[model samples]
Target: MDDDEVLLRGRVYGTDDGAPDSRPLPGRSYRELVGGPLDGLLLDVTGWDAGQLSGGAALMTELGRYGGGGRAHYGPRAGDPRCWDWAGDTP
Candidate 1:
């Protein structure tokens, strides 16, 4: 967390599978999606949970799973000042 940085917070539920229940972290999303968060999500976890994320953070990934179809995850990725992906949303 810094002046030029932002943090999207979420609850990490460790699972017996060790893979956990989160997505966007593994699937084919994190590379493009996490970089798009503007980013959790470790793999297919681009959706919502009992958590909070920035506007850009909400824009990318499979947010469809969260915010009841992304009602809470709406906004422009370019306009949001906090909407930035440190990885530049690249693979």
Candidate 2:
């Protein structure tokens, strides 16, 4: 996938808050946050075919795996990490 697609997914999967902030996350590319701050990442898959969704999911899964271990540094800093943790075995 291209850098733009990776960045777009990163932003979408990073934060939950709708509030705007100028502080950029570590290892995050500025190019991704361009076009003014986004309330949330919006993907319009209105006409996407099943194949397309499958492809997109595969891409996202790979991207998530690539960056998965870096979650501590990449995820939201203020909220409970458990909220974003998807690996289970939470205390």
Candidate 3:
């Protein structure tokens, strides 16, 4: 509800199972995925550590590189600190 918080469209997933009603609080926030197959998806950073956040994770998506259910690889964008960028997809 703050001026800085912008509600985005799409599905949100986290380690806790349920998605937050809105953008989470600071350290327990979510990162939006931009470009590629997983665009618009929110990745929960609620309990992610430095390594997990930095190394990134392979997320499952129906729209894969080969056109089927597979994992989409996303990592922190070089200059875009607000969201993660799609690297590629895998089976």
Candidate 4:
């Protein structure tokens, strides 16, 4: 990825009730409860299983469509760089 690529990272922690709260602060327009870099998003849910990852990917894709950019999917890898190119083959 080029220097133009924006890299945003955040984490999600849940309470004993299994509800997510206290996400990373938004640095862009969209109210990202868990993620950022509002444009040209490259999400890596590789930590999750294939099914879970696919579900999150689909959700992100839908959200991206609404947000005006696009979404891509990637598989799990050791020390994968969180950048545009590192985002594996789309779908």
Worst-scoring 10-residue span by lDDT in model 3: 1-10
lDDT of 3 by residue, 1-91 (tens): 3321233344564322244544345555677888766677678777788888888778876566866668888899888755898898888
Model 4 CA deviation exceeding 4 Å by range: 1-7, 11-67, 78-85, 88-91
Higher-TM-score candidate of 1 and 4: 4
Q: Candidate 1, residues 32-52: lDDT per residue as tens digits?
A: 223333233232234534243
**TM-scores for every candidate against the unseen true structure:** 0.21, 0.21, 0.68, 0.25
For candidate 2, lDDT tens digit of each residue in 1-91? 4554544443444334343432345453232211212212333334556555333321123233345332111222134321221231111
lDDT tens readout by residue for model 4, 2-90: 44233322332111122343233344221122332223433433345546533333233423334433443333233532322223222
Cα lDDT listed for each candidate: 0.32, 0.31, 0.68, 0.32
- Candidate 2 all-Cα RMSD: 14.4
| lDDT assessment of candidate 1 | 0.32
Candidate 4 weakest lDDT stretch, 10 residues: 28-37
Candidate 2, residue 31: how far the Cα is off, in Å: 21
* Candidate 3: regions farther than 4 A off: 1-8, 14-27
Cα shift from native, residue 15, model 3 (Å): 11
Best by TM-score: 3
User: What's model 3's TM-score?
Assistant: 0.68
